[model samples]
Target: LAKTTQPISMDSYEGQEVNITCSHNNIATNDYITWYQQFPSQGPRFIIQGYKTKVTNEVASLFIPADRKSSTLSLPRVSLSDTAVYYCLVGDALANQAGTALIFGKGTTLSVSS
Candidate 1:
């Protein structure tokens, strides 16, 4: 597991694009970058995941550089309803070591307003 560093908060208006970047300088080669979004009183939802290069889905896009030391999550045309806390996680699923659980850090809060 590698530690992630992200902003504490961010502000955006409706229909705006928001990009939240996370840094994992000590990331291992086996680790993959995963992003999750959580709204108030709800469990975190998986947004996207990637190893290297770009990966996009209906909800968001993940961009990882060649070094794989960092990743950026892009949310296009966000709306007020898109406001939530975003988490960036790194782990190796194949490791299968004991006590291997998803470790969560203080996520970046995105505030989408009108």
Candidate 2:
């Protein structure tokens, strides 16, 4: 697994668009960028994932540059309920061969206010 770099914390208001960037300078060719959100005392949930281009879902969008060294998770019209710890993970797509356990780095704490 590759290490990621992201902001320690962020502040936003309701109905605002939030973009959190994660950098993985040593990303491997077989690795994919995945984003997860974790609330207090809860497990992390998958948000979005991408390899080289843009991947969008109902909840958010993932943008990956050509170099694949970094990625950004974009959340639209976020509300107070959206506040959580966002993690950017890099790993292989194959579940069994990926690893024994999922490892996460210090995530970005997003605080959405009114």
Overall lDDT per candidate, in order of appearance: 0.94, 0.92
Clash count, candidate 1: 0
Badly placed stretches (over 4 Å) of model 1 are 97-100
Q: Model 2 reaches what TM-score against the true structure? A: 0.93
* Candidate 2 local lDDT, 1-114, one digit each (tens): 788999999999999999999999999888889999999999999888889999999999999999999999999999999999999999877756645466899999999999
**lDDT (tens digit, per residue) of candidate 1 on 1-114:** 788999999999999999999999999989999999999999999889999999999999999999999999999999998999999999996687675688899999999999
**lDDT score of residue 98 within candidate 1:** 70
Worst 10 residues of 2 by lDDT: 93-102
Residue 24, model 1: Cα distance from true site in angstroms: 0.3
Candidate achieving the largest TM-score: 1
